[model samples]
Target: MPMTSHRAALQAWLEAMPFRREAVAHLMAAQEAVYLVGGSVRDALLGRHGYDLDVVTEGSAMALGRRLADALRGAFFVMDREHDVARVVVRQGEAHYHVDLAGLRAKEIEGDLRARDFTINAMAVPLRPGLGELLDPTGGLDDLRRRVLRAAYEGAFRDDPVRIIRGVRMAGAFGLHWQPETEALALATVEALRGVSPERLRDELFNILALPSAASALEHPVGQRTLPLILLLDPLDLEGALEPVRLLEQALAGAVWVGAPYGEALEGYLRQTLSVGRERRQLLKLAALHLGCGAAAPQKAEETARHLRLSRREGIHLRLALQALDDPLWRAESEPEPLSIYRYYRQVGEAGVSGALLALWAWPKGSTGERMARRAHRIIAAWFTQKGTLVEPAPLLSGQEIVRKFGLTPGPQIGALLEALREAQAAGQVHDRAEAWHYLKRLIEKGLS
Candidate 1:
């Protein structure tokens, strides 16, 4: 889109947004020259709405944040007292937005713009009513028009190496290609990336993974060159890492149904909420990529997750993806029988869906292997579709029932018997109470139960 058309669209969109006006009014009451700078201005020009608004002013940023928070009945937080930066968080039901205030880092708005990381993020607009003119000192509008991501200056990466990770996210989110100079500068600062804090690295990583085209983001040449530097550890199996992502994309697209209830259910599985962020599905796929779909993947997942300092909940999600690699049905070259699928659901529960997705492409492509993989996929789908009935049926014999019937003590033996009975029910070997008792007698006769 041309700059003229984008400007018109931006104006229409900005005019339609009434939420921002309240906060702007609060800022105006302070009688300071304030401008809506950074991401808010960039997103507005690029036709993106609902992004956090960054406001820069000559007055104390902390005071401005407190004023806005008080007026809007929002929460005020001091982001960086030393740098005169603060934030006001406003919540409306389940939705939330941030309005960040910061003192000018340099003498003028142009200097502040030049000191930013990217050309596309170095634009600003007035927050004062009737004075909403764009202040683009770095030609951010032109770069947005061209769909090219360019560094604001050569030292942008050197200033904060984390920007390289943000670049990967922007590539996937906005479909912007990095300029050669920007890419070169970013690669040159690979060593400096090690100095970045783990929390920042972890946040950027999840943010990148959260994108719909996350696979493309990781597989893209830019990501290929940047990931190793950011990860900063052992050499990853890059091809192995990309395969599960490709499989996940296929599953999400309905090309592969490997055992999720429906395509939408599987999609919802991928979008499942996590303790930290709501990208559990994407993180699980990334985990599968890192730990190849092999028997030893779970151990590798543990080691890698520890090295990355993942949160406790994130570790659980990663383990679930790795656990898929350990499914025994995959060991059988033939299609999994109904009993095998039931047994899998019994063991892994809902997590099996994610595991199956990761393991789908890990299987061989030979004719026999393809058939087995498809069968495994169908079993997963059936487990989701029939979870209440076949997958988790009400066992005819409980632990207490086994203890009472056989005159045995309530011990591990009775628990084992209960498990056996449930397995029998799932395998279709026993149905009603009479058949369950008969099956138990056969197990005792064979000395198995």
Candidate 2:
């Protein structure tokens, strides 16, 4: 799509609301400068389809947002009560949108544009007599045309250093090289990111890593400053450190990530949703990056998770993936013992899939690396196809049943024997209940002898 005026998109977006566009139209009637501002305008100009709406007006943003929320049958959230900021969250089929409403920080639209972090985001289109009239106080349209990113003002990063993270992510996402001034400002103020709140830093970092071209985003020079401080990795070029991440991406896309074959077995697993709209792919990529931490990789992963406030589920995934790098069970062989596959899933649970993929990426460095990657492929295959034994094998005899049959009580002995029985079952030694009992009896007799 060619870069075009966003007036049609803005119109269609407003019209799509369930309660019609009356709520916003009413607000526009009451407010002198009700406008679609910031990134929404920028994205629309770039021919990007986005549902999130950023609106700024002179009137009470809270009241307007509430009305809009009710109109769209969406949930309303007060972002900043003091600042008269509110958000409306609504979903249209699979697409979700957060329509953020805020009263103008500056008195005029021009001042608001001048105050944003980047030029492209500073533009606004009025929801008035003529939406065609583009507000280009900072020349966002021109910058978009040039495919360049520029800071809106010299103090853009100083006023809120969080913009440093935002700038790099946006720059990479848009594939726009930073203007020299923007790059200098980002480099000079990179250290200021340490002072930013953890939540702010985490959200931005996750957003950065979540980008489709995350490696490209991390390659931004800004990450050289932010990553070591935030991610706790040794000072290294993010491109090289993230090679595993790129490999994982290829594997997820069903490509040759060190010769692993992609097939029906991986389709759904690869498309797993970590939480809400967040994909497991993002955390998987993060795990691959931390794999470069060498001996202290797990510790560094822990610190990074804590620093970023990663969810417990996400933390577990990273630990499992990195751990798989050195695990004995991570063998890639054509026909391996079922015990190894069973033990792997048992040890790592759901993260075994993540671990397998990481192992595929990490174990391709030397002669052993090739062997391990092929083993990782077999593990993935078992996970998808041989799940009856390897992925989720049912126990032949429950611990309660074992206790009843053996005239024993529920204790550690029963638990240990049950695990032994399960392992035997995984080894294909015990199938029926009689076979399971016979195996246990032999173990008991051997132990006594």
Predicted model with the maximum lDDT: 2
Candidate 1 lDDT, tens digit per residue, 65-87?
A: 88888888899999999999999
Model 1 alpha-carbon drift over 4 Å, by segment: 5-7, 28-30, 254-261, 291-296, 362-373
Looking at candidate 1, what is the lDDT of residue 71?
A: 84
Candidate 2 per-residue lDDT over residues 1-449, each given as its tens digit: 25445567656655666432654565566445688788877776676665577889878888888777776678999999998999988877886778788998888878978999999999887876546477888888888889888999999999999898888789778888889888899899888877888878877877887777777777768765777766755675233676777666655654553343547546567567766555677777777777767766766776778777887777777787677656665444344688877887888777787887887675457977777767777788787777776567677888888777777777888888988887887888888889988988898778721
* lDDT (Cα atoms) of all candidates against the true structure: 0.75, 0.75
Error of 1 at 414 (Å): 1.5
- Maximum-TM-score candidate: 2
